[model samples]
Target: MSLEWLQRVFGAKVLQFVMILFTYETEEECNTIKDDLKRNPDLKQLLEKCGGRYLTCNKMMNNQSEMRDLMKKIEHLFNENQQQCYTGEMPNTASIRKKKLESSEHQCGHTSEMESNAHLNLILLGKKRAGKSASGNTILGREVFMSKKSSKSVTRDAAVKSGTVNGFPVTVYDTPGFYDPKMGTEEIQKILDKVLLKCESGPCAFLLVIKADSFTEEEIKTVEKIEKLLGEERLNKTWILFTRGDELQEENITINEFINDTEALKKLIQKYDQQFHVLNNKIKGHSDQARLLLVKILQRSFGIK
Candidate 1:
């Protein structure tokens, strides 16, 4: 897209957010390109050096600068659909929850058992070594999902574990890491697509896990990509869960203060209407963080608040 068209569509700042935040392709397509780039070292370097010979053949100025500019505009155009969600208009949480509850209530026949023992369907999303499985264990209040460090991936596919948290029957789907640009193998993609089946009654919410210690540029892009893939509807139901709360405690800073330090992180929290909570996955047993997460989900997903 031309810079002029971008300016007209979502203004300059949104354009910057998109350009710097996500790639110029759908989630699957972008992953495939990244895979190809990694598999071919020479081709990858060529892409890095020239962007593409044909695209830069006509350029007389610095090739790298032109390529960077071209990429930003391309990414901005690809992420144009998400622009509507953050065009300076905030989402009404009550209305969103009411719409979700209408369907959830329908599936349960509005019965007392369903009402008193409602299940919260949560899908955890994040990158490698981002503590997704550990977070699941923390929420389940047990070792339902093995939590350990490794050079490779911990959760290879999606796994569902159901348990009660704060009086709510909670079903959590722990998804494999997809933060690596080339991580979307067919099997991983298939599992991610299937993870939402837990909410056949209509999925209520998604939990985006980010480590409080380091909210890097790549992590920011992962958030944007997942947000785009989930689309605006599910994103409204999405909550940001920062894992490794101990880091925040060590730094002796509140999440609000940390968010204020970074523009991209701030924008993400604002996009979700400040629906974020922290989890110290390293904690051994039941956690107050898990309880608070359940409460927030009830309010955000079922209008319980």
Candidate 2:
């Protein structure tokens, strides 16, 4: 069920109770209720609290009849609470269904003190000469890696840099920009496999660098393929790092507006629910913004506060 559905039925307190039920319920009848709760825990818990209970009679015919009656009562309770919560508005069915799938994928885990102190792992990806290396340096607040202007990719392999940002640790991975179109599709797959192996686990967030003055069709294609290779939902863990945002300021146009105006850019944002962050690698003062953005990305990835 969508988070909206959860909120509508149980607010937040009882929703937490339903989560506990999912963790503890194991009997056949309780498991069935738990499965229903998994879909709409808020609704199930609210119904149970409001004089609703599972009834299984000894007689087979009576058991079936009672199950039907209990289901109808449950539905009625849900409808009543939904109206009270939404005030005459109907919930979006698609959103509710999508949220059910998302909820299943997200396992609520306990966070230890050490895990709370963990830094976010951000991987930078783009075409050659897209200033990916410079962006990393800017985020580190120093020239930690070589930023070359040669035609070949300066980062021949994946390299990681870790540092503290506003008291939270941040690790940025500088990777080779995949730009060779002449190579066969299989070769590109091999290259990506190697890169993924080097990364160990996929980075928590991907920073797709695009030069402020230059946006190319190749960059768009790269983003699309990456989205396909990693499921579309994975794009939520991405932030567009537009290097040289200072140049956009020089033009008296905000990078946000410029990206919104471009159809290709708009498509990327829409695909990821408008989740994009801009960084001016040349601006020293704005590095904090980049760090803050990383924190937000990490929170989303790990479901941390």
Cα-based TM-score, every candidate: 0.61, 0.56
Model 1: pairs clashing at backbone N, Cα or C within 3 Å: none
lDDT of 1 by residue, 71-139 (tens): 766665546545443445322443355457667876877744235344567898988888989999999
In model 2, how large is the Cα lDDT of residue 296? 63
Error of 1 at 209 (Å): 0.3
Alpha carbon lDDT of each predicted model: 0.70, 0.63
Report the C-alpha displacement of residue 216, candidate 2, in angstroms. 2.8
Q: Which stretches of candidate 1 lie over 4 Å from their true place?
A: 1-117
Residues 153-252 of candidate 2 have per-residue lDDT tens digits of 7876667797756445567788767665444446555665665565535346778788877556888887776556555665667777777777888899
RMSD of candidate 2 to the true fold?
19.1
Clashing pairs in 2: 1-100
